[model samples]
Target: MPDKPRVILDSKQLELTINRLCYQLIENHDDFANSAIVGLQPRGVYVSKRIHEELAKMTGNKNIRHGALDATFFRDDFRTRETPRIPDVTELNFNVENLKVILVDDVLFTGRSVRASMDALLAFGRPQLVELLVLIDRRYTRHLPIMPNYTGKMVNTSLSERVSVEWKETEGKDCVKLHTVKK
Candidate 1:
């Protein structure tokens, strides 16, 4: 039997975590003048939009560069998938060369998506620096060398368990949950 879904970060806690991440980003980027924020497409766009909005409100600069990137076509497993996956739109309209690029995503699992996102970014330009920021980092599950530079939360779980992040815009709520799948 599958176990009941466990709430990892509730709405209030998720907000707090996001706030902390914003502060950390501010501390490092300092006004984001030479930095670009790129949110991964599909689910990651929500978290990236929130972070971009918060950064604007906190820095008093609404002109910060923000875009969404879709890495579907660049994924290594794209050809192996049973169903044909549709590619999402890539919204990056600015150059990334010589700039600090921060990649935002909702979850960091096997690191395959992060790797794919990096490949997808090549069409824009080579960034001087690329950092990853994720809402949830599923520890000990990485299949690649990728790691999150800033993580909202670190969770430990078995390989069969799945983590899901819900946002107000998508699921009508903001929360992180872990589900046990019976294989």
Candidate 2:
């Protein structure tokens, strides 16, 4: 049987969190005139898309640049993984040079993903500033030094636990769950 999932953020709460994150983004990058939002591909895109939509609505700037970044090749343990790694599509088409880039992701785990994302982003262009935005921040589990500039939730999880974020656009609903393996 599958392990029971502990509810972290339900649909209502998820919407609130997204809205809050969007407001926070607006607070920092007012009109996004000199900024862009890039979602770390695969899962981050879901969260990023929501933020992009809401922020655009809030700022009335539909021209705000949004892109997708795939960091599979940039991961440190790509070759070490038992399963073969397949890279996702990268759809960045704007110049990131001298702009403030916000990197959005679904879950902040070991900080390795953020590190790989930074490396991947550098290939596009050198930004004046880079900030992180995550739906869930898994605290005390980072292997590298990294933190999110805007966070929806802060969860303290054990090494054996897993944090999964589901979005309505893809998962049929929005929710954050903590899954513990059955012992």
Candidate 3:
């Protein structure tokens, strides 16, 4: 564990970023008319809801499906942790087959979590396409080639640093921060 760093995106900035991201998703895919938002659990879930709210206001439609996914079992580092936590339930009522899926996450770090999320998502159904939406794209040492399709910000960092994304739903605040381990 390491001491957290200074705040990056404050509450106001985070809201603006979320709105921009939702708008970008709509603009990127003209067929967002039939797309679904699937948030990777924990922070991603909160981001999905916020984006969904913005989308509803922009599109004037409230039918877009928002779902949550937990990738604990799918993670490659599951064995590394002494006590593996139980995975949260994945709930997506709509069929994902042939539907565009926007996988949302708070931060894009090592890409291992995104990879695990993909593995978990496959159990639901094969989607037509899966696009990643991340609030902070911290470009550190990546083990995989995974990249985010929609990014609010890109921060170059060292391997010893950590990016933290906080949302009101979970953290009682909306902000993004970068933490570095003190040597």
Candidate No. with top TM-score: 1
Question: Residue 91's C-alpha lDDT in candidate 2?
Answer: 94
Each candidate's lDDT (Cα)? Answer: 0.93, 0.92, 0.86
Candidate 1 has an lDDT of 0.93
TM-score of each: 0.96, 0.96, 0.92
| Clash tally, candidates in order | 0, 0, 0
- What stretches of model 1 exceed 4 Å from their correct place? none
User: Distance from true position, residue 75, model 1, in Å?
Assistant: 0.9
Q: By lDDT, who's the top model here?
A: 1
Best-first order by TM-score:
1, 2, 3
Candidate 2 per-residue C-alpha lDDT over 1-183 given as tens digits, one digit per residue, 9 for 90 to 100: 448999999999999999999988888888889999999989999999998988878888899999999998899997788997889999998999999999999999999989999999999889999999999999989998898999999999988899999877777888999999865
Cα error, residue 83 of model 1, in Å, equals 2.8
**Model 3: number of clashes?**
0
lDDT string, candidate 1, 1-183, tens digits: 888999999999999999999999999999899999999988889999999999998999998999999998889986788997899999987999989999999999999999999999987888999999999999999999998999999999779999999988878999999999987
Ranked by lDDT, the better of candidates 2 and 3 is: 2
